[model samples]
Target: MMKESVQADASALDGPALFATMSSMRAMRRLKPDAVPDETLEQLIQAAVWGPSGGNMQCYEYVVVTDRDMMARLAPLWKRCVDSYLATTGKYAPAGMDEAAYGRMVAAIEYQRDHFAETPALIIPCYRFPEPRIDEEGLIASAQALGPAGTEHLMNTQTRFQALAEGSCVYPGVQNLLLAARGLGLAANITIWHLMLEQEWKETLGIPEDMRTFAAVPVGWPQGNFGPVRRRPVADVIHRDRW
Candidate 1:
């Protein structure tokens, strides 16, 4: 049964302000296999839906997966992605990232990939589109209509537009979910590398290829604690009114 509180806006939940929970939200990749109650899961979903959407038409939806067998099935796909990334990239560290820290992060993600089946809940967040957004034929048409240079620009625009649209519609909800989970003392993380095998994964989930999946989020109790996260100072990344 669904909880009454889930129906109410998370803002009026009579607890901490949802916005304040952001600082505590961290990507908790290492999780325990303990089961999470549905009512609690309901809170996360409710909070996710409260996120802002264009014209108030909330198009984001989530598929909550808790069965370990299903996760086990995804393990090989996840491994393929991780191995591909590690092999192609040579080094996992991004520019300006400390080699040691990035190495540790890579190791942790590798561990997460290896033990994905142990995760308690796998949330697949998607952007439900009305029609084909990334059709190859459409790109070819655009390429012919506009010159090749212009076609590249057109295609870039299309990709950017879709990404921006989906990001605007889906990421806020994902943020809300992370915050909600944090408030409830649960841990979660989002990964998109698995999309390398998107076709097969979508088939496994019974989701149509046309519907775009934004990312896969796994939620569970953490084996590690959420501590103060390190990041570049605001002064470094923040731009004033004019850069």
Candidate 2:
């Protein structure tokens, strides 16, 4: 009877414990260029594989690159893409900002613009399907799994919902990799710029034609201090039951 009661208490504690573990994982920036050891990286990969996948398909594939020559070769493409993003973003700059603040912001942007290749390691996550047609079936299965619906929605609506659900599975795997790195005293950030250059990057990395790149993550020990995260207030984001 005592053992049974203890087991019940342990089960009840699980949710809060999991939430606390997750909340403590802060996103880190300004990582040092020291390469993460091979064994440590394998542990992070193992953690990521445990993340949920649609139909347990485990469709994701990852390519880890630490080669100096390859990173140097790819650096120019990343710089060009980031520069373009910054140029476009500048059009939306706030009015009446002081010159000093504006200059600091531009400098920060420029630093990040050039730093991708300098990072110690880059991991590219990709997904592959047996065939392109399977994408449709996968979409349907993902949506129906969402929850009960009284009636079938339009195809467009279902597609959007399924994309969201599928994204949830893939991103958590990325998050697992990041958090596991943090626990091991490393820093990482997931970026999409490499995916933006998918064609060129795929050719350079020898990624198969069937694979689709999802994200690019740079990992290393931290070079600078972490700042507090800027976010909306908890009340703004949370609701008791429904909005």
Candidate 3:
């Protein structure tokens, strides 16, 4: 479909239509090699900015990569990350998934990995936190009251807290981008596989040294159809008033 057609169709989605779009979104790993227009990409980012951020700081930024040569450069890095993941976390089927289902998912990932250089565009969502303003004296006093063991535990978990704070601002926007892509008839999936070689990715893309990328979303026309996404039943996961 043409870019103009995509934009028009995306904009015309009503409330129910929007919900329908959200319900049908799937991680489309197998994508066509066709180019995505810059205008459509801009619309996706525009949708992303509409999402809220922590304290409304809006610190997120996007790197829209359309250059096939650059993708070729990053393809080896992508391979290393995918290889590591496949050998480790992705090696076995998860608890509820059957081996066949897991194998199919792995095949799609391998397909995307091998064709990394051919992806039409990759959108990387990045963020960098500003210098924090906090009362150091009060924090030190609280830590001291907690004693040595508590202080050590807090120190060890500090990095994790910082990462969660950063993700709180960036991931909402990433979800918006994904939803926008689905609405526009484009295939897109959010993946953090690049975090394995984040520093190299930053250097390659000219992202600032301090900025962190949260996801690498490959976007293009899909080779297959988009349909309903299967998930656990609503009742199976919900907590009414408390867990």
The sequence of per-residue lDDT tens digits that candidate 1 reaches over residues 1-243 is: 211111223343355665445544668888888999988888999989999986577777788888778888888888888888888873555666667867778888887888888888888888774554658887777778888788677657977886787788888998888888998999988778868888888888887767788788888999998754555554555688988
| Most accurate candidate by TM-score | 3
| Higher-lDDT candidate of 1 and 2 | 1
Each prediction's whole-model lDDT (CA): 0.78, 0.69, 0.88
Candidate maximizing lDDT = 3
Tens-digit per-residue lDDT, 1-98, candidate 2: 11111112223335775443344444454656677799988888898998888777888888998888898888887887777767776634455454
lDDT against true structure, model 3: 0.88
lDDT of 1 at 229: 52
Preferred candidate (lDDT higher): 2 or 3: 3
Worst-scoring 10-residue span by lDDT in model 1: 1-10
Q: Count steric clashes of candidate 2.
A: 1
Pairs of colliding residues, candidate 1: none
Q: By descending TM-score, how would the candidates be arranged?
A: 3, 1, 2
Q: On residues 126-212, what C-alpha lDDT tens digit does candidate 3 reach at each position?
A: 998887776989888978899999988988999998889899999888899999999999999989989999999999999999888
